[model samples]
Target chain A: MIARLRQTVWSGITARVRGTWDSVADAIRPAVPGFGTVRRGHVALVGVGPGAIDLLTLRALRCIEAADVILYDRLVEPEVVALAPRKARRIYVGKEVGAHAWPQPRIDAKIVEEAQKGLRVVRLKSGDPSIFGRVTEELTAVRAAGLAVEVVPGVTAACAAAAHMQLSLTERGVSDTLILTTGTCREGDPLPESALHARPGTNTVFYMSVRQAARIRDGLIARGVPDGARLRIAADVAKPGEQLLHCALRDLPDTLASSSISGCAILMLTWPKEVEALSDPTVATETVAPVSAANAPS
Target chain B: MIARLRQTVWSGITARVRGTWDSVADAIRPAVPGFGTVRRGHVALVGVGPGAIDLLTLRALRCIEAADVILYDRLVEPEVVALAPRKARRIYVGKEVGAHAWPQPRIDAKIVEEAQKGLRVVRLKSGDPSIFGRVTEELTAVRAAGLAVEVVPGVTAACAAAAHMQLSLTERGVSDTLILTTGTCREGDPLPESALHARPGTNTVFYMSVRQAARIRDGLIARGVPDGARLRIAADVAKPGEQLLHCALRDLPDTLASSSISGCAILMLTWPKEVEALSDPTVATETVAPVSAANAPS
Candidate 1:
């Protein structure tokens, strides 16, 4: 009887999905919601995962093992780059600000140069390669140069950070929206209007924004976001020197200062909807009293 | 001189990270940022990537191999569950609607029961378990049961969809924000106020929402989201029967109706900051010209 009703309700929905999906309407899901395209290719863009080599996806490992040359970013640990065969040339294309830094275009050209040589090229990035990783530019370059390139998705840092912190990026009703955005933009681009997007039912994780901590905090405060919008600062997540710290939004700048944290950090700003602890049976006992989520019964 | 200048500029930045970090100020990073906590545990919450078993992180694979009792969701492929040792118990905790469904509480209790028996319990969820996975409830249950639990992150479906489409979730200088939100809520919860959060510079991926396609499309149209806001839908992403389709926002309803896509899909709604194709040198030639992002020079 329920199946009949469900079928009637979902007349346009595919029966295959409806059979397995409770949402019956849940038409879509993100298999790995960052990036993927299985194309025939000589060059591959691979996300090596955040910090831990163990976190690397099987696809990433396979891509690395098959590479004849690897152009890796700075955050990619040497140990990860070492996964390439001994004969593979490991080029350090780390984009730090010093003399060793390769500008975005240079990195693009180098990848193209190697791919044009008919060598298997791996453009290794930390975390999922498609988010805030300037992948479009490289992707554009590879295409413009007439090389077949494929992107192999890997564990993004945000997911890893949340896992390490024992936190969920999106809480059911409390935080229905999860936003991943960079805290900083291109050097000359206008500072991201980070505070402008705030709304109920939204959680934002800022990537590459620690130096702008003070400004970001001020913007959120100026925009009247409550201190209840707690800040979770995770540093070197999953790396040996990882640090997880929590504070109100107001303490963001100081937390980074005193925490001895380095780079590759994400600032998770969440304001889980307030719920009455006495009235809500689903409120977790271990959650911070003010910002706890209501795991309402389904 | 440049190194010294960079050093002076990065006075507060951790030397360890700055040596490897370009931002020098990246205070925290997501090393697979969905959900993770390394605790002493017999119960493990494992995210098994979106679909493909090989997409599973090394950590997730390890957790499954070590399990004495594996409780998996519906989206988890049988090949994945079969990875457990022959003696391991494979329990189906998938909460599909209908008589066979297991309530969330019962599933939690089952896990607790298994753990109390000194069994290695693996709570396997597809995609990253931290987002929209009802993990908090399960995590709470495990904690309340006084059992040590660990959450091993996995590649989410969003990453997989984007990769399959050869698209990036967040584009620099354009769509800097990526929002991951589900289409439907629990049976009783209010419909997600998705349109209210629409703003420039944001890309949203709607998970488990294909059933709500019409309503969602109506909501977006009502909220005045332009047709320029394109929709890319990928169904059964990375699975054997994966399908990738694209349409304008107004056409979302019909697109799904016409496409034979089943479940395990994600709706990727992207409004890449409009760029003048002629002026933006870095704009991808292959990108839909109207929705292309300005790959602005850094």
Candidate 2:
């Protein structure tokens, strides 16, 4: 009986969102009243994708439509922010390129204060919140302020870029593990030693580390990572003028150093099986000659 | 012009589904079609969240409704499978606790073969495909078979479980990073070292390793993880009979050792600050006493 009722409500939501889904009108009529108004104190932290509104999830769209206030960041597109109810107040807490626009405490206070006012605020962010989006902090602060929070997951730029490029982060016997890290940490800290020693089967995703690409490469090499690993840099994934570069780790620093590509890029180090399968056999022969010379114990 | 055309198509779609979304129906028309249809040679890897259909993504729900054939595993609920078009063939490739149903190689072959026939095949997984679902392998195989594949992201078990418990994985300075790793590797390989050392500012998610909780706890302790860190285990999130146990790593083995909680589960290790911020301080001081010893230094 509960299942039947749920089915009705589900269909109702669908029908309410898209007329084509109205074929189940008979199944949806009864559940309409229950979803009338969302409860107050409920917060939806939504990912707005790289910069395109098209990549927004349907739930994210619905949640935004119902918001009373939208606390958005600089990275979110103007078009996507426009989705919030017109009457809903829009607050910008986005950080400037080099400066921290809004401090952490202020953002937390805003969430708590708005939620206290019984507003369903959508804390809009760019890409997936689980990554370096800094959602964990805001959600923590809000919860501490005695409010309810719901995270509506969004597509991360890494996934979007990978999908756009038809590249697999992991492949059988090639790369079986994926590591996501941040490159925004200060200079002296080099790549984490353990991450540097990631098994050959692993792929690493470095977020917000575009300017530090050369350092990241040097750090990885210092940690004993092979110079021959395949590295790809994806910037502005999903944006109209998005850029991507596929090259070897040794050459990546030079390939991207002088390039004008900038802003919130993801650096992916992958051992693609396709490349291994498609590489010119003569290239492998050349690589082995040098590798054997280096490995020949003195 | 393209945006307007897309809006036209979307408005038509929204009108067909929900009639109109409030007074601004004109402003928020469908920019794209609802429930994206799978094209030939394209595999939609979807996650049917825990067991509850309400937790399923609106897009995932539509894909399942329109699937030509659903290749599902044991983790997917029977009710979700029933949602597929009545005429859609349902192939069970799930592995029961002790029974080896269909090996992965066979499943991959079937997906490739079906796609080759131009059938819309949905590899319906229980949780997020990018995580432990091994959708990567399926993606590689299908693409190798000369078919297009698109992964429809779903609510990972960790997020669902966290949502069920109203917990935040990353809370401010308490936890800045969220690392997701399986509890145990197949064939007795050691637990991931990163998961064990879960840094002071990181949250670790363990999937499909509930049975080996004791070993996992031991590994963490050996890695010098602080005893004060917070640990939470949620089994069968969003489903009936869901269970959540928030404790320290050491106490987990004893608490869950004798009991068998099946289905999907998520083990989260978070920083103290994040936990303190997200949890009710009063409730934390009371209910968490028993497991306080979990943080006792090794």
Candidate 3:
């Protein structure tokens, strides 16, 4: 009984100590200063969204404005980059097919190098940094150097494309699972066979798949995906020259051939009949005018 | 030759007129007004991000502040809802297990009703609205009523949990595919058998899966997923009292038992040896303090 009483007393003391410690820590914690004046030796991985200035999160904007040096990529819009303070250094380390101005390892090293120089660094990517953004390498490098790191999520291309199209990736009783994948696999590293197949009640979005349209079509067809399945290809999404094409799965290659889609594109596969029927005709007419005109053969 | 020349001249005139019309349209397009002054009868479907107020996008925050009537869900943070203008009407339509404060159809009707009344309606949801936000129903309803609608994407729980963990959903040479799915399948809705299996070089994240831990474990094990696979559970992510637990796949049930996990949680399955090796020990130690303390039995 005495032992149990002693244990209770010790537990009470421990709880009170922890409570006091938490209060002290909360009181002493530093407040986040205004943008353009972040503490040195810290790094913020900010997502700039899908090339639209307004799509940028307030937190991402604050990070960009506060950074002493910002490293950006090709897909990020110039207008979005302009949001950085005039005093901030802007370095374009864009990577295009067959040409990488700055390779991944080099980019990771540079972020760490800048942070170690007592400068606030922002490694900005176009979409949500955690998705296809190669953030783990940079995050690992930064933390290894004992620098503070934070990731700010942004609108990925899939979400932006859906918003621009006024479509939902998942609908109750239609699609419950939304899978976001890329078509551009590394050399000798092919995606799983299951990844190519379109499952029922699930929406599949293929990023960087414009160039591989034929391969995707053949694979899906081999997997028994109906030729009549609907596909939506959005190019330069959310931009002024944005083009959206809705066609059958079998027409994906033909549709690509008809349009000059030589940039980042999102290929969405959804339930054809249900989705098409649900789309508002007025919205479709308004958004599809440019694309329809562009697709007209002279 | 005379006929061809006349045709060319007429086409040139048409092109010039169209160009002039385009320029005028661009000049007269309405600029997005400041928050709290959105045009009436318009509805903005805004994603409020996963619980953190700062994680909200600039567009989302603008929509919330500008809204005349803000309809929010249970998962959205109170601070985020508080961002709405003082005069704005706030209604809670949160969905809890066995208790939906407002049915979906009713919610849709209310949003349409408010919008038709010439009030700026903001339907705020937790995470990117297009993903599992039931946006299609609302979008269809608003468009059917001939009301203006716009969608603003925010950081989903998957992205926020990834950011909090300092892990990337996709990593080159390690994980090329990142699949986001849910564990709470509706009645008569069973997930595909293949989804239970962990693919090589892929990361699978299950949102709202804490209650389904045993089912997930059994399914994955049945699918030949190594019992030693790594599992990370993040509860109340990005909010105060957030808990993160990292354990082997087999230990999922036991680890969950030690924590007070009730609200929204993210279950992340990553490759075991490689991911654990890649995570920085210092960062892990710093972030795991609370979970480690919570897990210690008295």
Which 10-residue span in candidate 1 chain B carries the lowest summed lDDT? B289-298
lDDT of 2 by residue, A176-214 (tens): 455566656433443332233233345667777676777
Error of 1 at A67 (Å): 1.2
| Per-residue lDDT of candidate 1, residues A114-201 (tens digit) | 8888889999988888787788999999999999888888888889998887788888778788888777787678888776555446
lDDT accuracy of residue B179 in candidate 3: 69
Which consecutive 10 residues in model 2 chain A have the weakest lDDT in total?
Answer: A288-297
Highest-lDDT candidate? 1
Best by DockQ: 1
Ranked candidates, highest TM-score first: 1, 3, 2
lDDT of 2: 0.61
Model 3's i-RMS, to one decimal, reads 25.0
Candidate 2 local Cα displacement, residue A279, angstroms: 26
Clashing pairs in 3: A36-A66, B36-B66
| Predicted complex 3: CAPRI docking category | incorrect
- DockQ for the candidates, in order: 0.17, 0.08, 0.16
User: B4-39 in candidate 2: lDDT tens per residue?
Assistant: 433444344443433332322333234335323336
Fnat per candidate: 0.40, 0.06, 0.38
True contacts kept of 2: 0.06
